[model samples]
Target: MDNASSQINISFNFISDISNIDYKKKKDFSNVYNIQGMLNIRIENELFFSEEIALLEFYIQVKKWLSNKFDGSFYYNTIEVEGDDNPLIKFVASDNNYFISSPWGQDKVIAKAKAESLIESIKIFTEDFEEELYRTYKLNPKWYI
Candidate 1:
């Protein structure tokens, strides 16, 4: 689905920026995964960012776009971030000042679909997130590979 190489650069840029975002600190609470194919993407940046409300808006946008492209598939079914306690990305936002890393993601691929469908889903998903680069990656997602 992604014949052009334009998306690679965009996706990389978005992933690289996650560490810079300063997530809120709190215990595990309720952040609604109100959409289909909502997966966790863990990123670590050296520079800390401010204003999670902006970040939250970015996330919602990313999820919706990804869902449309992948026909409803989420990444990070099991993800590991770059700077998490482990290489595997795990993040849990409790409030506005603390984000915790936990190795609790599962390693499951959807069993109901054919391998062809999975491949198509991944391709579309990749492109979808890529579109968010420069435009709005925060509104984009870290939909795992």
Candidate 2:
């Protein structure tokens, strides 16, 4: 049997752009409408999965950003925010293959605020990583998108 956290490090590099629809928007018969509705539902599901993958990618990238900033060693599928009084930000893959929580906030702006807050509050810093990490703050979060 596979481990519970097996899905955490699993990347979805094969997902196609679900937004690239060939369908045209037009008035159609009721029956066609029903079929289109069903297809739309499927498309929505695909979009959801795509979003999930994107968010997960963002999380992983955040870890890399942290590592790059602090010159900290990187580990596979491991997340850590080191500080004696730092907020609890341990995110690991669960048995369900999803992260139990997000380190970043609901959106990019919130995520940036969270990062900034952590940087200011937490004393965890390495001489090598500090400069790089601070530079990341100047970058637009949209770059990750």
Candidate 3:
């Protein structure tokens, strides 16, 4: 909560894929498939998502945004932030874009701060990943994106 402000505003909207496979897979879960595709980012204290991938090229670019390891899971091994208990988020290609939604907040934000800082914490927690995890992640494109 912001100390200066009496009320704290929370924004959260999890977009689900519009498909039986996507819907059933997501099943009201945070990490599933964004049928319309999403490029989530955070600046200041707010979060945002480029909900629509109008072009196929953009879809590929967004898919390339993440490292291909997680199985619909969202977690920073460097930090203990719990990605939803479900599988990790996945990128499924589709032509629908206008149906994109706002950049929604995750149900659980281990720390209410910038995305880069939160990622840094997780890197430190991993223990075996790297002694220079933060230093490395700092150079990552996501930091600037």
Candidate 4:
């Protein structure tokens, strides 16, 4: 497959039913544990995963992985929502190529792109997600220790 044709698209919306929950804390920070959202991911122009997910946990995991510097390969499992099983997503970087895969998917290699291209896509997704959280909730999430 042509690296130029590979793509990754992600978008999510925060569920708006947290009025009863105490999300705010001291120092103007908040927790995302109770927050819910529909996360949609598409790879190579095809829908890969679309379902409700634990928005905060997902963000933290992705952020942590990105902070690791994308060394050799990175793996992440989506936090199960509403009793659903976690979906394993893996990204392998080798020789300037990136291979994305999932055990639950029909194919082993769900998508492939140049290493730089794939990393850029993920960075954009993370930045956009962070902005959305701050815009909607008006509080920064307490970093996961």
- RMSD each, Å: 17.2, 18.5, 16.8, 3.7
**Per-residue lDDT of model 1, residues 1-145, tens digit only:** 4221111111122333433432351111121121112233322221121211222323444455445643432322212224432322212222221232234333321112232433343355456644643254232333321
TM-scores for the candidates = 0.26, 0.19, 0.20, 0.73
Query: Which candidate has the highest TM-score of all?
Result: 4
Location of the lowest summed lDDT over 10 successive residues in candidate 1: 3-12
> Would you give me the overall lDDT of model 2?
0.26
Backbone clashes per model, in order?
21, 4, 12, 0
Clashing pairs in 2: 69-129, 69-133, 70-129, 71-129
Output the TM-score of candidate 4.
Answer: 0.73
Candidate 2 structure quality by residue, lDDT tens digits, 1-145 = 5322211111222132324222243122211112111000011112111122222233334446565663432222322334441222222323222222323322211111122223322222222223432242232223232
Q: lDDT per prediction?
A: 0.30, 0.26, 0.28, 0.66
Ranking by lDDT: 4, 1, 3, 2
Candidate 2 C-alpha error for residue 6, in Å? 11
Task: Write candidate 4's Cα lDDT for 24-116 as tens digits.
Answer: 452222455666787766777777666666777677777777888876787666545223333566677767777766655444446666777
Stretches of candidate 4 off by over 4 Å are: 1-5, 24-30, 78-87, 103-109
Predicted structure 1: clash tally: 21
Q: For residues 1-145, what per-residue lDDT tens digits would candidate 3 score against the true structure? A: 3312111222222233233233243333222222223334343444433232312222223333334432232421211124552212222222211111122234433223333343343333232222222232221222212
